[model samples]
Target: MREALIVWGGWSGHEPEQCASIIAGMLEEEQFRVHLENSTSAFASPSLSTMSLIVPIYTMSKIEKDEIGNLSSAVRDGVGLAGYHGGMGDAFREAVEYQFMCGGQWVAHPGNIIDYRVNVTRPDDPIMHGIQDFAYHSEQYYMHVDPSNEVLATTTFSGEHAPWIEGVVMPVVWKRRHGTGRVFYSSLGHVAKEFDVPQMRTIFRRGMLWAARD
Candidate 1:
């Protein structure tokens, strides 16, 4: 069975613990052996390279140099890395390498907890298959993303909240590679309950499986 390590902590507003539990259950249902940790120290595990996938639920947390280095190296060596929202995107603000592996960093959420629409940009991609453009009620993430990402979904700013970015199209979901490893990210799920959104949950599930080592 594939092994997955989920490290949860940093910001309680994101409900990292609850989100980790939800994801652990999802992976367990997929027959993966899921391990859960509440601290960033888990990233320093010497056995990290043995895991098939790693999920970070840490937001805006400081990571030691050696810890981030080990995590980055593991992903570069073919271990899958996948996560969503502030957990991965907003984590390790000072760690450029971590942001690079994630393909994007959460810069701002114009209208916090507001209504928006997500457009399916690459419906043909397996991770987005059968998913359609849908209405979302959460922070509309404005991010600085890697142009190399294979963007699968996007959102258009209405200018109602942040006028300057009006009509700007931002990536809502994307997948990329760091060395031989697959990296997937979605700018959704601000809180644990967001997972109840069918489209949100389904896309995340597929994204995780898609990033896992074969």
Candidate 2:
């Protein structure tokens, strides 16, 4: 069976443990040998190098150089990395290398919590498949994303929240390649319950499987 690891920690407001549990259940349903941990040190495990997927549910927190190095190397060597929201996108604010692996960083959530629409830009992508543009009432993430990301979905910002970025199209979901590994991330799921949204949950489920290595 394919092995997966979920490391949860950092800001508690994001409900890292709760979010991890939700995803853990999903992975279990998919038959992945899922292992869960609540520390960044889990990134240093030798097992990580052989795992098929790594899901980091950690928010802004410090990661040791060796831990990040091991995780980065594992991904580069074909172990997939998948995550979402601030846990993965806004994680390790000071760790440039980690952000590079994720292909984006959560810079801001203008207007805090508000209603927004997530437009599917590339319905042809396997991750998107039958998903369509959907209405979402959550933090519309303004991220610093890598230009190389294959953007699959986007959202337009209304000037009401951040006037300067009005009408700006921001990437809400993207998949990219880090070496031989597949990297997936979505700006959705500000909290665990946000995954209750059918489309959001479906997109995330597909993203995780798509990123898993053989």
Candidate 3:
């Protein structure tokens, strides 16, 4: 069976623990041997490279240099990495290398929790197949994303919150690669309950499976 490591903990405002539990249930339903750890130190595990996937529910936390290095190397060596919202995008603010692997960083959520629309960009992509543009109520993430990402979905900023970015289109979901590894990210799920949104939950599930090592 494919194995996955879910490391959760950091800024409780994001409800990392709750989100991790929800994701763990999802993975368990899929029959993955899921391991849950409530600490960043799990990233340093020597077995990281052997796992089929890694999910980070950690947000805005400091990761040790060696820990980050191990995690990065594991992904580069062909393990998969997939996550959503601040868990992956807003994690390790000072770890540029980690951000690079994630293909984006959550820079801001201009209006905080607000109504927004997610427009599917690459519906043909397996991760986005059958998913359509949908209304979302959460932080409309404005991110600094890698140009190389194969963007799957996007959202437009109204500038009501950050006037300078009015009408700017920002990536909402994307998939990319680091070495031989597959990496996927979505800027949805600001909180655990957001996972109840069918579109958001389905897209995340497919993205995780898509990023898993073959």
My TM-score estimates for the predictions, one after another, are 0.99, 0.98, 0.98
Clashes of each: 0, 0, 0
Model 3, residue 206: distance off in Å is 0.3
Query: Candidate 3 clashing pairs?
Result: none
lDDT of 2 by residue, 33-129 (tens): 9999999999999889889999999999899999999999999999999999998999999999999999999988989999999999999988899
Clashes of 3: 0
RMSD of every candidate to native, in Å, equals 0.7, 0.8, 0.8
| Full-model lDDT, candidate 2 | 0.93
Question: Distance from true position, residue 89, model 1, in Å?
Answer: 0.6
lDDT of each: 0.95, 0.93, 0.93
Q: Could you tell me how far off, in angstroms, the CA of residue 157 lies in candidate 2 after the best superposition? A: 0.3
The TM-score-based order of candidates, best leading, equals 1, 2, 3
Global CA lDDT computed for model 1? 0.95
Give lDDT tens digits, candidate 1, residues 1-214: 8999999999899999999999999999999999999889999999999999999999998999899999999999999999999999999999998988999999999879999999999999888899989999999999999999999999999999878989999999999999999999999999999999999999999999999954
Please identify model 2 stretches exceeding 4 Å from their true place.
none
lDDT of 3 by residue, 31-137 (tens): 89999999899999999998999999889989999999999999999999999999999999999999989999988899799999999999888888888899999
Residue 55 deviation, candidate 3, in Å?
0.2
